[model samples]
Target: MALIGRISLDVVARPQEPTAKKRCLDEPQPDTLKRAKFSDEDYDANKRLRKFQESWKVTYPWVTHEAYDDDQKPGLMFCATCRAYPDLADKSSALYVGCSNMRVDPLKKHEFSSAHIKATNKKTKDTMTMKERSELATNSPIVKATKRCMQITMNILVVMFNTVYSLAKKCKPLSDFETHMELHVKNKKDIGGDYMDIGTNYHNEKRAKEFLMSIGEQLRVTKTRLIEKVRFLTVLADGSTDSSMTEQYTVLVRYVSEGYPVTTLASIEDIENANAFGVKNGIENGLNKIGITDSSKIVSVNFDGAAVMMGCKSGVSALMKEKNPRIVLIHCVAHKLELGVLDAVRSIDYLLKFEDIVKSIYKFYARSTKRRRDLQAFADILESELLHYGDVKTVRWVASKARALRAIQQNLFATLGHLEHAASANKTEESGKAKKLLHEMKSARFVKYLHLMMDYLEIITATSKKFQQNKLLIMEVPDIIKSTTDELTLMIEEPGHQTSTFYDHYDPETGDFTDHGDHVMKLSGQRLTTYEEDNDKTTLLKQTVKYLEVRFMDFNEKPLKCFDAFNLNKWPTNDTELVKHGRDDIKELTQHYIDILTDTEHSSMLREWTIMKNLLRKKKTGINCHDLYCELLQTQPADIQNILTLVNIMVSISPSTAECERQFSAMKLIKSCRR
Candidate 1:
């Protein structure tokens, strides 16, 4: 009974000569069966599965068939390029492997996909050699456009750099960048095309400041690199109060570059303290900023003769020497001369009073425009040009004092005429003051003091100017001091040119004024005895000469005196004298800078020195040390490197801190109250 029931169920499920609708309802269709078979993992050998079509290659060139060993095995479709380089193929795409979905839709979708397009390009690029690819890239329009854009950007940056550098050099405000850019765009259209629009972002003050900072940093880096290459340098520093009432320290470095001494500003920084420690720290910080960490490289330091700067036991100079025992301490020669002259003048009561009167006269005229115009009127009537009255101060420049004295002397008659008119015509307090000044100007004693001071300052002023030279060598300082002292010594017996003119107006024996034709100065005061006048003149001359001798006595001593060996003009004429000349001094110099020279170099220097002297004696050279060094460099010998280095060190020692003073002047101009 069970077999009969099973046979009946099987007969119901089976069908004879199946119709299309019955087959669709009861069994899978041929196409559906083929798709199902293709989806199977082991369907590659199935004949019922869909096969790759050759016609699809016409629609998709990348389409190709996967091969099988058996002819009856089903074929599969894939992207030939993606299959070749599988790394470039999209893993999510059926085309990465072999696709059995034989319809054209999947091939078309992959052909338009980003991955397939990327893969196609990579494959095409790979087929060519490196040189072929390079040529193709070089000729590509896209590459050309990219290069052009980069060039335009660089040109715009160059223009902006130049503009910022110009404005900074002129000390103009950076806010003017936009105005400058506009000017450039209008005048220099060809510099950068369409760069104006791009440069708008950089036209503001913020960007201009950044540009300036970048340029400054680049320049500083270049200067630091140059400083690092030098073996020896001199440090010049000074302290001052700026517009903001901040204690500012200005530092300058002097070194030899290309066989010439160059003095450049290292820094101008605000300091919380101005004592020795503070100043020393500031100098170290400035040197460190320029990459000079080795203090031993410092051959010398120049500063004013302030107690804190020049004190032997504890001062900036002493502190610097603690770091390198060989470092020489230089008291600024200009300041020394100035202090010496002023001290000598102040020692006498009459000259001290004369300075005060000169200052008062300058203030009286300088403060009043009305008085100045009156003075000018008097000057015009006298057929003389009115010179501006300059103030005299203790710490002021000798040149300024000279100018003030010159102005007063040239306009003395005119000033007296104005005062005479103001005192008599006007009845006011100013008139009263004017009368008092008139009385003082008409005194023979005041006139004599004025002429004497003018003569004295003239000699000192010339020496001060010489000391302020940028490349002034230590060897030249002694001669300057001697010449100045000699002139003052001569003035003790004979009066100066200006003073001699005054002597013409007076009787020497009686010390009384003589009436001279057309002389504007009619002296009216208690006449001095010949002994008193002669005593005043002699006292002033003798004191000035003595002060100079005592103050500049260091120039005749050790390390400084050794530099005189380099002064070719001082070399002895005879060979016997020449061979032995400066030998002790040269040894002293090498011993002074012993740390800077190696033992090998120290011994070689003497030999090189002898050779150099002989060579220079044979050659036509300038008498100055710098000129001689230049000649030595031109005919450089194999063993003279040490000698050349010593010469550079000698020349690098500046005679004064004038470079620092000049930098301060520039700083005042650049950072004024209005700025």
Candidate 2:
């Protein structure tokens, strides 16, 4: 359907000349095509300028062939200053001018001009004042727009990286955001949305890695500043294997920053082995690379109680101490506690049997798909959810043992039903294993010991968690160890704690007092023995308490005992009693450094110790010792400088190397099997 009729009005021009004769297919190229695609106006402009030889540099050394514009048919020469700052051009100055003349030696003439001399002496735009640059930048639309675009692109990259890091997500956001913007540009141009295509590099894996490295460099710079500001810090080191099975040691620096504990991950180094020599070298090289020039600044070294790390003579800590006598070595308190728990558990026979039974029940379901399915079916029939069994983490974190026990306890009824059903079925390998698991799960001894170990390890795991806290103070650690030991002692001696934990009935509705009567009744063949014969629970608790006391007794030895004096509890409130304190622990603590300190400084420290006691009594509110020292620093009291110096010594003492252990946890996430 035609909407309107077309109008036909045409006029023809008179033909004055005919087209040129057609050339043959194999004819030589036309003269017009043989010449470069220069327009007549450009040709005329170039013809007007005097051409100069390329050797003009001989007479004018500053003139270079790089100034030539190769895009022009005959090319043109430009002064370097004029090219760099094209707006500097003027009618009188040959220096601020460009020329295409074949006959005139403009370069030679321009070199001697006063304008050229002035332009050469002027600073480049990079050195220009901010105000001048801002004015110039804002006036030029192209430059301003380009800069705005570049700034926006950088902002986008920063936000993208921040989101990825903050959320602990992968690099997908980097590419995903770019892809979304690309799609929007394609489909929403009419709506005024803008996304200039920077293409694959902006969103690719290579660019993502480059940006990550750039962030690492920035963090390193910040870490360096913090380290230098603190001047002296303890080195907390630990080694762990990645998913790829490569042993990497992470070095962390612990120092007091603004009244709080500040721990920075200084470096992550891959070592040849986990031996003392290899780890020690890795640490030295890593710290050196990170700008820690003086080993003497390492006032203390802390690591786990591994033989290679804490060996008295040949360990990494010993090696460091040998190099610098001032560096005191301390083992990780949390790790030592975990080791004690492991030792206590392993020493008992019935407790080991309990652990084996729990592990066996987990494997019974975990190892067989059919068994897990059957358990799930039983859980569904009973209107409950099945719990997954946890693997025991042998890395001194006893929390996993609790999780495993809890899972079994939660699903005890359904799991037993599933096993009972399997046991009653026709004979099969699965049935046989199910019958055995059912027998153990129903044993009165197994039920009692499971509850026993679960409760005992809960205390150990809690202490572990407390030690791993980022803000825990070194002075606070001795108290924490004592309290933990006291809690274990209470757990051993107090019958109420025992009866409530191990023997009490767990109520599912109230989420307390779970009873094991029904699980014990389903025992295939085993029965409960007399109470006198079954003293496993009492024995396990006693062993745990004994081991803890032996392990934690390290706090009482030598220079470490001096740290206990620094605790505010020991600081005498009366000035008359300051010099007559309980023991001369400070002398022993600082005895090794007497040669390093001047007589005046030593006297100042003795005087400050007296004043520090008064300061503590004056500010009577409860505050952490490390925090109190930092607060005192703000007043800049001359009398407290020496006392503050002593506080720094205490602050430098690492309570534990748990942060390094946490880094390994992050390593597992970062370097996953798929990753």
Candidate 3:
């Protein structure tokens, strides 16, 4: 008190402190009235938002469990109407809003209304304040139950999402979620980053496994979209790195006989060797887990052609011998097919050069995050729609698809234009080389023949599947096989089919365009004006039709009762027909593949293996010796043992990489769905 008096005296002496403002003690004015207003524009916007929400609600049911954006946060059982309208306004007007429970629940709100029955707020016996009311119902059981129901729906959605991507579509958003949600359930489980899924928590391992099993069980309950009944299971194992850099192996098994591609079994395996062993066992277990097993029911095992899985005599291939001794070890044909194309590209001088340029471009574009973005920008600037959206039809020149080669032949000049422009900003030795390569690519003799391959691929891929499924509609495999082989042989043998040079050959005998020699001998040279466009189209059309017919015909000969049925064809007369057809097809495919691979840097050595498999098929009496090599080679061959491995891949394994490839497609959708 003394200190205060001293300060006050000091202030008075200083004269700096103005006379203390006299307090205005008069009472304040009364509060102003509040009014509500509405506009057509606001009404329209609200209607639109409502429509969007409702649409989302139908598409994404999990949203039902989710707290509405405008709803109250956890702790209340809000009526839908009241949840939508959280505040009451215009008491004298008909437009009313507020928690419906507050109006209808006599215990909570004595004046509750559903059909707008008017009610007045009645004082409780204690005349409780707002704080007192909340305190008495803080852990409200009704609110908790509402939240629990929401949690159940969310759990259902999560389980569905893990099994299939097309489950959860979209849900609408609300303006006020908090006012409606009296008891909210937060993310109760850790979601995985890989696939938008309820993630695995080691602390909850047993629960997670059970949940995963339940997901599988749920899929079974989902009307069993599986088209094919269980048959010879064709297993394929391939390893890949996830976003987290963990090396995960995916094992897929196809149940043959189904014409359409369907995943009969799928599983993700571990990385450790024990894990590798575990993965293999897990695959076997999962097959049983998905209803598979018994030795003879399993027909083929296809892998990445890795020695770890394919080595002769001692690997998993042999382990299968104890189960199904005749189970063939097939290599993924797409891998070999691609390898063949790479090999073929490597054989040609300009094509090889062009491929190298493409490699350089791919590397530059794919080197890092910044580079990829720059590549996209460059693509946009160049407006080269053919910068390979990552497909077979437009993979530069070498890695291009069979049908695209023809288009690429004509488009080579245009592609060069893109490469030239792309090179302008790239001031390196690569740029200069690329410019020269641009010219070679356009002039390359084999350009026109690339499309011819489309017919071949169409024939092979379709026919291969039909043959595997025993659903080939064709009669007499030999007749069709012979004709088909002869057709391709004859096509390749055509004089104009393989031109050697870009310009007309100047015949020394006549010094004119008239002395145009056979072009087949000149395939190593270039293109000519005589090359007819209709000729290519006609031949492709013929081949494609014939191929399709044969494939369908093949379906009739031996309905594919098993997956990976390479040699699964019935013997025309003897018990050896399956082996014969398999041997012949492998040789032919390997040749065509090798023909494509003549120049590829990464040689798949399918040709060598094709020969080896044929030799095995021929030696009918040497089961003991052949069986020795089978076990030895199928287990794990040394680095030098690739030749033996390649044969087993082509002769015995999955005809195509469709199982894993389909998985890849599914993975893409899964990622987007999760995101």
| Highest-scoring model, TM-score | 1
TM-score of each: 0.78, 0.72, 0.41
lDDT of 3 by residue, 1-675 (tens): 999999999888985646785646595544563356889988876752211233433533212223345644321222232233334222332223222222122322312343222112222314678897886565579867877777866865565334232231122111112211211122333332443333232223234335445665876544233422443356767666554555666677655232222344456655565433555675675455454546455656766556656557656666665666455555454454344434443444544554454454444334455534544555454444333323322454322443344444433334445556646755676567556555554443334433344444544444344334421211223334445456555544443332433234333233222112322221224333343443543454344445434433323332222212233223233535433434444344344334222343125444444444454455534443324444545454443244543333233334555456555545444334323
Model 1 local distance difference test score: 0.81
Q: Considering lDDT, which of the candidate structures 1 and 2 is the better prediction for this target?
A: 1
Report the Cα RMSD per candidate: 14.6, 17.2, 28.6
Q: 2, model 1: CA deviation in Å?
A: 99
- Report lDDT (CA) for all predictions: 0.81, 0.68, 0.43
How many residue pairs clash in all the candidates, one count each?
A: 0, 16, 78
TM-score of predicted model 1?
0.78
Q: Candidate 2 has what TM-score?
A: 0.72
Which 10 residues in a row give candidate 2 its minimum summed lDDT? 1-10
Q: What is the lDDT of residue 639 in candidate 3?
A: 38
Which one wins on lDDT? 1
How do the residues 526-642 of candidate 2 rate in per-residue lDDT, one tens digit apiece? Answer: 444333454655575667778877886767776777777667766666766755663376667557555445567566775676677666765646776656766775555786776
Candidate 2 residue-pair clash tally: 16
Q: Model 2, stretches more than 4 Å misplaced?
A: 1-146, 149-153, 156-201, 368-370, 380-386, 391-397, 496-534, 570-579, 593-601, 618-622, 633-638
What stretches of model 3 exceed 4 Å from their correct place?
Answer: 1-214, 220-234, 255-263, 274-279, 291-300, 326-328, 332-351, 357-400, 403-407, 416-434, 442-484, 495-655, 668-675
Tens-digit lDDT track for model 1 on 1-675?
A: 999999999999987876675454766567645643245556644547566777878878888888688875556777887777677678778877678777788988899888888888998898999999999998899999998899889888888888888887887877788898877666546666643544454776777888988987888899999998988899999998888888889988998887778999888877767889988888888888889888888999999999988999999999999888888889999999988887787778887777777887888888788888888888888777778874434224377788888888888888888988888875798888888888887788888877777888898889888899987888989888989999988888777877777777776455554323354445777765542357878887788889888888888888988999887778888999999888898899888888788887788888888887887786535366666675555555676777776887887888899888888887886777865
